[model samples]
Target chain A: MIEGRYFYPHATRFVAARASAASGMLRVEALDGSLLNEAPAKSLRLSPALGRLPARLSLGDGSHFESDDRAGIESLRRELKLRAPGGLLHRIERSWRGITLAVLATAALSYGFVAFGVPFIARKLAEATPPSIAVAMSRQTMQILDGRALAPSALKPKDRARLEALFRKVSAHEPRGAGGYTLLMRRGPGVGANAFALPDGSVVVTDALYALAKNDEEIEGVLAHEMSHVNHAHGLQRVYQASMIPAAIALLTGDVSQVSQMATVLPGILVQSAYSRNFEQQADDDAAAILRAMGAKPSRLGDLLLRLEEVHCHKGGCAPSWLGSHPETAARVERLRQETGK
Target chain B: MSGEHEAAVESGAARSYPFQFEGTGGEYFGIWIVNLALTVVTLGIYSAWATVRTRRYFRGNMVLAGHAFDYHASPVRILIGRAIAFVLLLGYNISLNFSPYALLVWIPAFLIAVPWLIVSSLRFNARNTSYRNVRFNFTGTLGGAAKAYIFWPLIAMLSGGFLMPLARRVRDYYHINNHSFGGRPFETEFTGWQIYSRFLIAFAMWIALMVAFFTFIAVSAKFMPHGKAVSPNDIAIMAPLILMIAFLEIGFIVVGIATMAMIYNLALGHTVLDGRHRLRCRLNPLVLAWVVITNTLLTLATLGLFYPWAQVRYTRYFLGRMALEATSDLDEFTSEAFGTQSAVGEEIAGFFDLGIGL
Candidate 1:
């Protein structure tokens, strides 16, 4: 028997009553021994018991019973042979060890998903994306940059042609050949030597970058790195991976304030840096291979990278480019120097 | 028994009934962590069900006048909505990456859909909530939703923020006046002037904090020895002071919380249910701010393990500050049959992080 409240169908009127499921019937009675309700026990539907909250029994006629005594309610359900949905889940919730395992597993799964699953999925998606879309994205980006910062190249016609010829050589080595690849030269007035590959294989190199290079070997090496970026469609893959961030954050803390989530910014940056770091390393290795194929020492690329960094910074340290940054830049240079020895 | 029952009737003198939340942080944590783990393990396929469980748990623990509230949304319905929302989100993200001009398409599409979505979400939540076998409901129309969520806010912004207080009043009225308990309406009323007063106070507080922050920073900088490297002693002394100053800089949150509390108190205090019982909210803004900011800091510090506790704490404090001023027996309401609402609007609103405007 459970002492609880019994409500009539579709009514807020409730009687403080005692209910008992005995034999094949359930009966609810007031304290005066007058019966309030009676139904076949099997007809009752039990709301899942959660925490120490009240458990409710629906009589299917909209009449229901509610009791705070969870044990009494569970026993009543058992006697009636009724299933309590979410019963298994609540039982696990009530156990400390289960909760502990849940926490650890959640952490592991989230980390594994972000670190491996996102990258793998994004790479597949990037590969599947049509080339027309990439071309549009690249064109829009370059147009915006042109209006905002980039100017027409100031390089002599001879120098521009020579660089374009080297760019074609690297493009020819790619499986797609040189048909789609193009060398876009622009002068960045205030911004120092810069170079980057767009999704549609437009490698934009600033005039200062060409001026900063010591020799043709250095220029060829950098061109190979940019070609690798274009060949692998790294820009599109980065965008796809970036698009997963807000969704992941929404899942984790759907209702949390932005202030509290501010703490996640550093970790989020670290994850992104980790991604770009891997890409930088791959481009470095690919550049090394291409330089060897061109019969030039890989150290020429390393020397030019160090010189570019020096030109980038007038004070403390040159801001790291998307291609490479400090510690990582040092590591890539060291690897290229090793390639030279071999 | 009839004589005793008759004697239990009130003489129209109001009595206050406080809402009690009986959930413990530890117990809720167990449920929360497990829900999150399952959602992750299933690769987000189970989030719809998880959301329902979490909402049910919260509703079940809130007791008013010895009866607990209940939430009864079907997980299957929610799952269908979530699947649609996920696809839409992926489409939006992909198109945006494909071209910035995608905004030209999405922004208008979203604006047109938002009114219907807001109304649907409100109706869905209300229809799923019940007390003593009688359901709560919202009878808001899309026209009302558009007026409150879109047109009013637009007018306020276009008016150089001068009409914001009026917009808040209109929005709150739209939310509160549309709600029904067991087929009886709840109506709320407040003057634009009242909200404007609160806004003024908030603005003043923000300005004061900005001044205080700069003053504190300048004072601290003054105390540092000029032309000398800081010693270990100074570093130790200044570190905690700097941390404290930085924490107080979340002062913006203080003003924001206070303004929210003020609005809540005004809206709830003036609310009348079936034109009989009244609702009251007496939140002291400073104290609520302290609780909220501290809760946020702790959640951040613990990397969100304290989230369940923070939610429980917030519920306890919020409900503790509310009371139902009843002038008669509270059991005469009857439910009206309403069709179940699809979860599409609710799920899409949630996906976009839209608050329910309540």
Candidate 2:
């Protein structure tokens, strides 16, 4: 028997009581063994076990019985052949060995999800995004760039036309062919000697990169890389990838305000993590294939990368970065050149 | 203890009962990690149950007078609420990226929904809590909530923030005054100028901190030798100034906490139940800040495994300072609450991170 207090239906006042389920019925009695009420064991409900607190059992008439006997409740449920609610979870919570294993499993699962699951999910999301949404998003990006980082093209008309011919040749070699992509030339003093693509198949080629390229093949190599970015929708993919980690963190932490500190670390992690390297590698591989399809050497793209690296690293310091970093450049260059052997 | 019970019965008045927290860090750590692991394995589908179990653990461990409090929210209801909230949140995040018109639609919709969310969430949480079988209740209306949460803040900003503390006072008043237990209202009364004074002091500390910073910079520049490397003598002069500035920065944060504690104390201190029994709070700002900062740092260092310990420590220390001055043996009450409130409002409010905690 468990000694506790019994409350009448919806009443606050309670009396000293002894509770038992030994007779296949939940029985409560005054201390002298006088019956207060009795019900079938299957008809009663037990609250979940929480720490070392008293367990509450409801008698379905709004009357409840409370006792600090977890083991009694466990045995009572067992004898009645009744399933205890939250039984497994509470056992896991109460065991040290179970907790340790849980911590290990949590760590492994989180790392696996963030490292592989997020990228795969990001790819699916990018592919599923509607073209109109992509167009609108790209328009906003171009507007922001124009307001801050981009200006009118300063290339001579002759240089621009020759570059247009190279672009057309690369576009023809792409799976979507000529109409699938478009190119724009602009002077970006801030972004100096750089090229990038938006989600809507618009590739921006800064004029300084034109001045930097030694030959048409080198420029075509750069176009091929940017076109690959367009074909795979990598820009949109990065946006989705960046948001996934914070979303997952919020979900696991109950999306509460107390975890705002974790949110602040997202921008730094998203901008500088290995996910960017994977995107760059994907685009590079595709660009190498496009180069080989155009009957040109893939190493021409590597040559431009090294040339761009010289301009950047010489100005400041030679620290490898997200793109064309000193050490990563050697690996990327060797990979692209190996495409030639195939 | 028997003699003391007889004495309490004889007087039937003016006795104080200190709130006690009996939970230990070691036990809570086990429960918290297990909860988190299950939540993750289910991809957050089990988080509603986790939240319920965690809250129940803390509530059942809190002792008031002689009886422990209890939380009785159903996890299945909370799960349904969260699923709906998740869909809405996902929609909001996606539309925010895909459509520029989203803000124009979302802002007004959210603003209109704020009062309902606050009222529903407060009522739901209050009705789930019980002491001695008598559940607490909230009877505040949406109009009252809007006046407190939206109207007061906007008016405060229009007054150029000189009246922001008054806005806080109104909000605390709205929260405390509308709550009832056993159908008797709880009331809190405090003047706006009292909170304003607290804000003024914190602001003064901030200004003093900036002045000290500028003074340190000037002193450092004055002691530096012209057009030459700084010597050890110069270093000694700069080091004391650096130390002073570091102290001032810490003081700035402590002063902010002091302001928070003042408001906290003022709100709880003036609160009364049944027009006789009074609630009192005496949180030390220095201790509060120490616990808060150390908890944050430790939680970060341990990658969140220290969370349960941090929570236990805070509850044990802070609740020890809370007390109820009773008028009787604390037994003459009846449960008056059984309203079935949907949990969606609270789930949505959590999605917005409204921080409506009391």
Candidate 3:
């Protein structure tokens, strides 16, 4: 007789069970001086055992028998020789060696996923995204930032028009059919001396950046860098990669329609330039190529970087929080100067 | 002495039904590690099952009066509930980005749903739990729960947290009055003013701590090495700053632990179960603080492998202090064999990471 509790659909009854090996019939009786219905042993489905946790045997007729008596259950299993498969999970739980292997495998897989798998998937997905969606998102972001950190350009109209004309001339030199590229001038002390590209083919040049640049070529170098970011959809890729872990979590938990929070978080990550070191290097190389194609000096961007660093680093040697994720300025300048033969 | 003392002494001479925890750290460690590994390998898809396995292990090992408790929550139900909760949370987060007005609407909407979630979580947990052929039950109403968990807390917060003890009283009363084992309600007579008086002692300790912190800061500033703009690079000035910072961190930790211990001891000492069964939990703040600090340090040093050991050590220490007195036989209680509870609310609360066991 097996010692277990028989949980009826509406009540719990502690019961004794007897299994007939020949006819494959199982009989259950309540231990509290009562009787229970007999059922075929074939109807019972056994759940996998984990350590001392009781295995649940479902009779599939609105009744369940749970027992911690491993010896009795094992003997019954042998007598019946029924095919009660535990799958991969049970195999791992059954022994210490399997558990160790599982742990090692899990650690390795998680590392690989985080380090390589997520970024790879992000890149592929970003590449597949329509350019129109990125453009619309970019417009929305600029509208949000306009009243917050930015204002109408304080630079003279001629100066603004000249830079806009220069940007159009450089962008038109090579048309990849990305879209019509536009130049936006903003007086943004909050963003002080920063230039960033929007996926909607808009290159924003802050007035602070113009004041820092020594000449038109230096400003052109910054514009080239921003343009490359837009050209490669780097902003979109960064957003996708930053949201990967949460997206994976949502997918695993069967939360398919929860894209709203991701939308909210995406803008911040994009503005912060949460790109991997590889993405940064790729954008820098592309910027250099674009500068060369424009017949402009590539080393001016490097010189501008050094000038900006000297001005900003004097205050306790701290970079502004906006530039926190950028590659080290010193190393980047050195590499760019090498490419420029300066 | 008193009538209660006499009855307690008489019962003490009879069978003392001491709650026993038969789980060992080493045995639990194997299960915990395995569950973590499986959950990660499955990319968190197996967490529903893992939760069940973990609860089962803990409940199965807790023995009271020669019978162990049982947890029979279906993983499928939990999975469905989790999915719904995740979607709602995601939607809420997304709505915040849609517009400022959306955020204004979302916060209150979620708050309004809290009372319902609390009720569902309680009912789900109670229905799933059974001991010796009897199931536990909760019959708390929505309005009562809302008053306890939300409105009272809001009033307390609006009053600079001074009325928190009153809120605690309301919450405890709601919880204890509604809780039942085998259709018999547990009675509590502990008053709100008693809780407030106890909390005042803790409030005084906080004031003392603040005074001490400011005094230490003043003393440190006075004793700081006077020189021509002594930089942090100077070893003479740096040494004292490092020592002072470490000392302040330790003091903060102690104050935090002491406050928690005081509140815990006060609550446990006042709680009564089944009218006849009274609980007395005597915990020393200093000892508890030391245990917690040491446990954290050890767990970190072992790279989190010592988690199960730390958990078991803490549980044993906390539960060991609790002494329950029963005036009558425990076997006489019988739960009603009707009513089915849905696991949706429990799953939703768990998924959204809300406080439920409170």
Candidate 4:
């Protein structure tokens, strides 16, 4: 026997002698032969045993009657059927395509802005600044600093020797054209424990940072990482672009009006900015290569990263202000671990 | 009985619409609200389970031409796919900065990862089955599923602003053409202008209401009596001030309801279809008004006890009144278990666990 349940229409007769259009306490039933009395009638249900069947029920005067006119009922029943489960899969499939298209569209749109919009804006900004005044201002500032009676003339003999040794160690296995490397150790007002690399190939490691290092290797790791930035020419590129281009524009365009404004914001534009993650990775790779070439363990970098992480804990994963343009200590540590397979 | 007699009985049954729809103990709404709440609370983890529950309910209860519906989704596949996507996104971001040129490679890699997900979902869903007296069939392709990704961003972007109407049109178009069953095809079309105009009017109304509300607030504050010292005149004026404030509150409630109605009407459009069966989507103004008023009072009075009931009532009214026209010989089945109270606990639990809407 082909066993199947059929939902039969429930017959409702209003006991009220008056024919009222209002429907209250309607009765309904399930295909499984379960009766639901005085239930609100929102949807009709029918379960069939064999082929398709269609019939409509009439509602009027507090009475419900099934009509032979199954045309409307069948269509309505079909409409009410639950959407197939495959529809979800179908939606997912469509979503995948939609995501791909969206990604491409976003890329295209961003590329358009970067390639066209940025250049246009740059040109406009350049047109607003003159080059000569910017050059003179920078030159004058350098002269003023140079003429300062408080500025130390040159490093002490022992400090010079140490700086020379550090430079040699950092540049020993540096990749060609990665970046030019320089080391500057000078005595001035104590700036706390800090180390920084300027865009002009100048790496300043304060005496306080040297005091904090557990050993020379940790210091070497720091120098190697900074050397990688130099070898990559990132520092020079940033400095040249930041200083000269704007200055040149200012001088050429004869617009020193925004020069003061630019000067005020320049430190923010230059300092403690983040390099791209990819750049960080590349620098990590470069540093790793340098350490390998110098016959030193790459784990030294990872160790330094951990120490830095502890130091920068309160800064929400950011490096200290001196190392602002660098990756967070946690990221640096992770990258080193990944590279060294430790 | 002979096969022919069996066929006749099935055919007859398939054609009957006798107000015989079953109630799944309000599990539908329970699950919906639960999932919605869970999604809100859990920050969307409950969505996966919610999706499964939704599929189970719809599959278990649906009857068409005497046939039931079946659905399936693999949690493992979904989880794994999500993990892989997350990892890839992380890697892609890293690659983007170090070598901006590397984005070229990442783009294609991202594209390739998508089809695996689409195919897995399709295979799992199609294999799930339901049958009445007749055999049920499920058919779909990877290409169809993959197309979804193409439109989703457009939908997202369009939904954000004046482009909502265009977005709705695209959504309607995609939804209509994306299904097929029993050798029959389903399709729908919506004009962009219709959606756009509706949204514009709704936005305008919202803006006007906001303006009026602020104006009333400003005017009331300005007119409120202020004096150097507390006196009989100042005390006497407080009664009218309180009344005016009460009146303003009522006005805000009315305006809020009107805004919700306008938004609902604009976003969903007024028509929906399951295959060739077309249903005119009508927003019952009266029902909407009751819901708005009742919801406002409930929220104000009980601090929110009546929220669930309000939700159930509105959902019921909307789902119940939607009428579908029959265009084919197959029996149509409708289910309305919107206001029943089954699985509410599960839903609430899921909502809390998922931290859904936050």
Q: Which candidate has the top score in lDDT?
A: 1
TM-scores, all models, native as reference: 0.86, 0.82, 0.75, 0.34
Residue ranges of candidate 2 with Cα displaced over 4 Å: A25-43, A76-82, A189-193, A208-218, A242-244, A255-272, A292-342, B1-13, B99-101, B158-160, B208-259, B333-358
Model 4 Cα lDDT, one tens digit per residue, B188-282: 55556755666665566657666866686688767665764433334455555556667666555555455455544443343333443444345
- For each candidate in turn, the interface RMSD (Å) is 4.9, 5.4, 8.0, 24.0
lDDT string for model 2 (B1-358, tens) is: 7588547536855778899999999889888888888888898887787878877888899998778988877666667666655565666666676556677888787777778768876877787777776667787888999899999999999999888998999899899999877566799997767777878877887788788778878887886668875543344754776588768766776776677777888899888887767788999877987876677667777877787888899889778989988764466533322221211121222232222222
DockQ agreement of candidate 1 with the native complex: 0.37
- What is residue A189's positional error in candidate 2, in angstroms? 4.8
Please tell me which predicted candidate would have the highest TM-score against the true structure.
1
The residue pairs that clash in candidate 1, if any, are none
Against the correct fold, how does model 3 do in TM-score?
A: 0.75
Query: Highest DockQ: which candidate?
Result: 1
lDDT tens digits by residue: candidate 3, A1-342: 788777664344444543333467656666653556556777777766655667666666867777778778777766766555544555566568976776686568766776678777767877998887776677778888997989988998788788777687667754443346788889886678778888777888888888899887787777777777777777777666655555444433232221222232443443335355566666666667667777777777889989887766643355334456777787777777776763
Cα lDDT of model 1 overall? 0.78
Q: Please provide, for model 1 over A1-342, each residue's C-alpha lDDT reduced to its tens digit, 9 standing for 90 to 100.
A: 799988876566777888898896788888777998888876788887678877778887878887878888878888888888889899889887898899999999989998899899889998998999899999999988898789999999999999988888877776568887889999988666888999998999999999999899899889888888888888998888777765565555444353445555655666676787777778888888888987889989899888876665443343344423333556678999999888
Point out the higher-scoring one by DockQ: 1 or 4: 1
Docking class of 1: acceptable
Q: Give candidate 1's error at residue A164 in angstroms.
A: 2.6
Better of 1 and 4 by lDDT: 1
The TM-score obtained by model 1 is: 0.86
TM-score for candidate 4, please give it: 0.34
Interface RMSD of 1: 4.9
